[model samples]
Target: MAYSLDDLLNPQVSKVTRSTDNLIITTYGARGQGKTPVATKMEKPFYFAFGKSGLSGINNVDFQPVNSWSDFKSLVKLFSNKKNYEQLHEKYHTLVLDEMEILYKYCEQYVASTEGVRKIKEGNGGYGLWGDLKDEWENEIMKIIGSGFCVMFILHACADDTGKIMPVGDLKRMLPIILNHSDIIGYVRGNGSDPETGKPIHSSLMLSDTDEYFARTRNEYFVPYIEDYTAENLVNAYYDALDRQEKAEGTSTVTKEEGDKMYEKQRITFDELMGKVAECIEKMCNAKRDEEVVDIVEKTLGKGGKVSQCTAKQYEAVEVILNDLEEALA
Candidate 1:
């Protein structure tokens, strides 16, 4: 076929937004951070449990225990079938790969076996073996993602000899591919049970990269960290952030300087808000009696009685109080 000048001259405008439901996400953190439990709460998740202990007590969510790379290939083949994929698409909204580090090991094992070698580096006379392994890994994974299933990868944090934590191992080599494909990479940490409900609470999800761990979110609306982490809460935050961005962009046509100013104005941070709350609490404690303190706390936080239990609106109201107190104290 000959190249067409007509086609060369015309280019379609690409979509500026993507569907939130189909995001490619990777969540990683220390063990017992509720990574698996929180992932199950994601939109109609279907899990591929690759680690031996990954599915011990999980309930209600559909899952398959993947043992070998060949088993994974069979799954790819099954999903390649049009009818089978349709059935899956109907039943599941997200396809989760639990314990991604183990999956990387499985890839290495498969590569080693296929080349009749004890180690992956022994394959192809030590030439292109790593590339081959990476190719196989990315190809198989992308096939499933291309089939329209939202993909979530879960990884456990590994600490280096120097005590730096990361999602490492054979996965370190595949980080580029994972990073390229994923829209969000969050590091989860902290563990506490809700005092009132007795349910497990994942304290926070860190979406910003730090010296200790790797994490990121491409969405500008997503905060650097999410407290009291859950998939539902995360999703709601994502959409709310998206809404704010969209509304900001829609407000007016302006120069870059004006737009940047507007963005900075809208960027009131969690740390800043919490700092204000702390200041207010300290002032009230110093200036009032015990009974007055109780009354003020009840008036501010209402029945929640704790900052963690407060909703977004309650936090906003608290922010208002903090501002008023600052002025009054000054």
Candidate 2:
């Protein structure tokens, strides 16, 4: 079924559009659920876990297991900020959020505590909190999606009285947002061993959406370099996925030199890039200026290369060395 543009534009009329290429994989089960296994398979990824431990077991990844909701909020804000993450994002690929149930709790508490909402809640003596928090929750979600980063939201599957599966945070009306916004939604369930009798076990990954569009393999976009549960794998997968997108658009990955130039455009300085320049200078001097035997080679000189004479990168190296000198003296 289709409708005219004007008809579709009305707020009352509903439409679904996937504007972001992000994938939100929700992993759930009991406390020991292997939700982490799925994220570990990705390349160049980082984990911000609110629960679960053994982060050291995973390699090629950065892990931030938060002990409190405040830590989670602050980290999320930092990661999404363009100033902090831009350089890091250039070097990495995936961002995974383990135990999204924690963030779910934070969102509820956050919205309920906001000055505007708190006033309403206080006036109502706590009766209006649920209504007040809906917009705040949506705003938090918008920030996450618009962050332009690959995110994985992990949750636990809870069994209701009816023995039906529900996401851990489903009680707070989070399931719908988790469902509608997620590029992929799934669960992990395992067999419970009967204490009395020995029996075979069965486990499966449950898909949330019945739509045919989601049935296609997500691997088509991002192919793993190898079989491993490492952040490097997530990173590799992210690159491959993005490369596939570029290939479809008739483009290719840029060389390191080109990528450096692109990064320099944003005022980012690479230590390795500076090291490469020093190596190149040494190579050229060895071939031509070896006879001169200069006592020291300086990339930048305040005496000759004044404040305005150097490029931003040259200034960076000079500033770093100067900072070292100041620290040494102190």
Candidate 3:
């Protein structure tokens, strides 16, 4: 079967009528800012702690301590499998990955071990290597995403020399791709002991992006800031955002000029290009037939052009194919 321009223009992806319990969330904060405790509050969470010490005081959490990158890869393989994921989902509805920075190190270690390179730089054929790392990381993460389980990724926040708080080092290189997958990105602020009482003050989660750090929720309905942060509140805000979306769907319409203006307002950076390529690869990976993969390639880059060779100029075409495939799948 072939799709025509009419089909492409009006996709068959069903209207999203209800809220989903599962979400992809990322939260970062300074050490001892209660990032882990906040995650532990998520529904039936199963933790995969990359660091050694964080979980000592945290209780009632079922976790697998990851000793090496290989262990983490094994877990990914296990959970990404459909039957295995089904069984795991019965017991755990959420998966929490702690220490995002450490996980990046593990990814680098895995890449180094497999590629026999100590340094990752464009000079050292790092573009392909970095792409490989990104592909592997994104591929595994998407599988987990498609698994229909809530995911909470925890990262440590660091202040740059000029005092901008954000993810640093290798993890910084991958933040854009990770953020593309997240529905919510929050920065936790754990209030330290009060001067007079030596007890904790009110801490909060920042959901709006700031000049100082990376943070944002998907919609206006999501609480811009969460005070006395708990996983429940975050989840509720997610539902509210969904409810608003559901209510607003088809209630109003966008004129072509307005749609064009809205589209023009979107900033598609190079990192987003990388993200689209990742999505293309993900589609190829899950493609039911070799012909479907070939169709994607032909539709995006013309015959015999590899997706790995896609440039920024090819972004819109790539997105069109991806959207078509998504609608077809849906």
Candidate 4:
């Protein structure tokens, strides 16, 4: 079928309906840190308990007990199915995977058994088996996450040889894969005395990464730490961040000339470029050294030139500076 010149030249504009919010949240912490209870507090939660330990104190949340990797796969399949997806979505707003580490162990065991090996690193084909297991686990979990349901994975924290806290796993490759897919990664902390009550605070969620533990949030509006970790609080924070982002985007528009220039240079929209530049400027200002800021701008974006006047190559250099500054500040 051939189209007319008008059809080819003119494009219809539609209202944007897609959201940039991170619906997949992963939380890791020590045992009895209230991870399960906090997760269960989400609206219309459907919890999948990989271990019975997390189920002791929680109540009133609909839950399913999954003992094996096969069970996990079956659940994923049910949710991924189009016919069943709508029903599940109506019944549950959030799907919680309690003790995701146990699920990963089950995946490891299943992989080993299927390959007729005693361990993941067994025989001459150990690396191949590990790769297969990693792929399988990532594929299955991602399927559930992409099924249009808000998903939360609850993991047990373990320290690596370098003492960096991460989800319990033998394969170091697994952590990055999971974190890459997650929108929010949080660490639950407790074992501190409350100053006011002088009582033990069972748990708090750290939403940003520090030198001691691995955690992060894509939402800039999200607080670095939440003293009370609850499903309601987490959901509220996420929506609030989304709202702020929407408002910011609404005010930031790219002009036709700017859009054309960006296109010519294979660059992003003016608004996005300016946002990055603004962030870099703010960080530089926070450093409180005029001479250092001047040197950085001159070295990256050129001497006496504003970011708005930067070429694509200069913008890339400025971005590199921004990344370095962010890491240094962090």
Candidate 5:
């Protein structure tokens, strides 16, 4: 996992690799399909509120209210420190309110040359506090990511012409955290047919598991799967490389002693190293769980059992295989 200067020069990761500092997830949809609901479901374990009011109709969620941006920043710091948010999620995760488009807008404003960065201030459409929003957003995202828990960024998308790409939308002027960060790009679509005909009309999850899939569908590696004439079989494809690394290397062991060993070898910040160790403790610590899956796979294959394809999307077979591979990695 050696990182060369050249690799850093360009702001991209290797073919199928993922780093801890950049675990980003974004979900989009037209209407219904519970895109937010599913996202909220995932964050139900740890939902922090910024305003003083109740979540009102928000279900399957745990709410912690914050007062200001500074408080939010402080929360991010504590989580990264691994001191706070330790109990929120056994693994440490945070939910930022409407973070996606904000970061996108932040990026756009940053590129426009903000007021604070330019100083002097031009309130009349001139650079202002928002001008420096991008730099601040980018720095904060890294902070949250560094802090243990996984982050969930909610976003809104619309069609924008005059650019490259379709189902296109401006990152709301929020662009900083997005320009160089965000590991996963997800879109939410709903089944569009007849209710009597068993058509789904809620938000569906269309995920980008690999660059190849992205290129094939949108002719652009990052374009979301929201265009017309698409299928209801939108599958959530994510990079499995992270889990695979642990499985591929038999060297992975789980005792505290082994944790320390892996920590030193990983050489990321100590906290990040420890976080992985914690997750490992939950999985590898139990020998039965680790061995059970491989045992099942072997027995199934021995019986001539073939993997089935039930992925809603077209090429779902590919999705099924990748899922199997991810299981192996796990």
Candidate 6:
């Protein structure tokens, strides 16, 4: 059925809210400079060590030893599985891709082997192949993100010919893609000594396109510079910033009647919301395995519960989950 102009212009169409809980943090530093230490401090971190740099010094952290690009891809698939995601949600809060520079090299090698080419260049059509590989990597990353895990990438910093510290890879093509998806980029530095203790002081500088390095934070509360960098410290800083922003927005003083009126103005009806939910579920089921789809429904709406029986709040939750799923599939 076609809608009239009034229905089409209805303001109560239901808007989506963004979650600030998940973070994408990228850190770079020289070897033995406490890059792994920062990651080790995160809540229940699972490390993917690609540089053969085993978590020798780090204790009691779960890690997967990745040898090749194929291994990493398989690992991504494993994590994307619905059953594993449920288990992982209970066991881990963060996923760390250690030494992303090595991962990039492996991606290059994988492209070369698959395309029967020796180098990635535009002339030999390897550039297009590299783009495809990058897309694959991005899809896996987004899936992990959508699964509600904090994604962290550790890299070894490289100095360009101009002595500017940058992520070690195809900066022109690949770095922008990585940066665009990242919420924070930090450059590690540890040269100064503590004034009182006479011990070395290590710090990570969150950048903003400086002449010396590339760093930034989407969170305004971040000082754009940190004298000390620890996983707990950064996470706390983020939430504190979020809290400040929330407070700055001020609390609503509307009464129940006023609030109800406002909500009525913005809220989509139960039937309208269910229609969108059904369409989203159909798309999700088509993109995922049947068991995964069933698991998601059960988790969100209870065992054997149909979408039609969901309450308005439950429908909102399902909508968010389905949106994440569709984005991951995309």
In terms of TM-score, the best-performing candidate is 3
TM-scores for all candidates: the values are 0.67, 0.50, 0.68, 0.66, 0.48, 0.66
In model 1, what lDDT does residue 271 have?
Answer: 63
What residue runs in model 4 are displaced by over 4 Å at the alpha carbon? 1-22, 123-128, 191-199, 251-330
Clashes of 4: 0
lDDT of 6: 0.69
| 139-250: candidate 3 lDDT, tens digit per residue | 7667766556778888878887778787554554557666778888898888778999898765689999888877887666676788878878877777677677757664
Q: Alpha carbon lDDT of residue 83, candidate 3?
A: 75
**C-alpha lDDT score of every prediction, in listed order:** 0.73, 0.54, 0.72, 0.73, 0.45, 0.69
> Comparing 3 and 4 by lDDT, which wins?
4
The residue-by-residue lDDT of candidate 1 on 45-87, one tens digit each, is 8888786788778779898778999888888777656578668
Could you tally the backbone clashes for each prediction? 0, 11, 0, 0, 28, 3
TM-score-wise, the better of 1 and 5 is 1
Residues 63-177, model 6: lDDT tens digits: 8888888888888877767678668767887888887777777877776677777665532553456566667666655666554567887888888999988877676544665
After superposition, the stretches of candidate 5 with alpha carbons farther than 4 Å from their true spots are 1-22, 50-56, 91-96, 99-131, 162-173, 197-202, 208-330
- Model 6 reaches what TM-score against the true structure? 0.66
- Residue 224's lDDT within candidate 4 is 86
| Candidate 2: segments with Cα more than 4 A from true spot | 1-21, 52-60, 83-85, 111-123, 160-162, 191-203, 208-330
List the pairs of residues colliding in candidate 3: none
Cα displacement (angstroms), candidate 5, residue 286, comes to: 58
lDDT of 2: 0.54
Off by over 4 Å in 1: 1-9, 16-18, 80-84, 126-128, 160-164, 191-200, 251-330
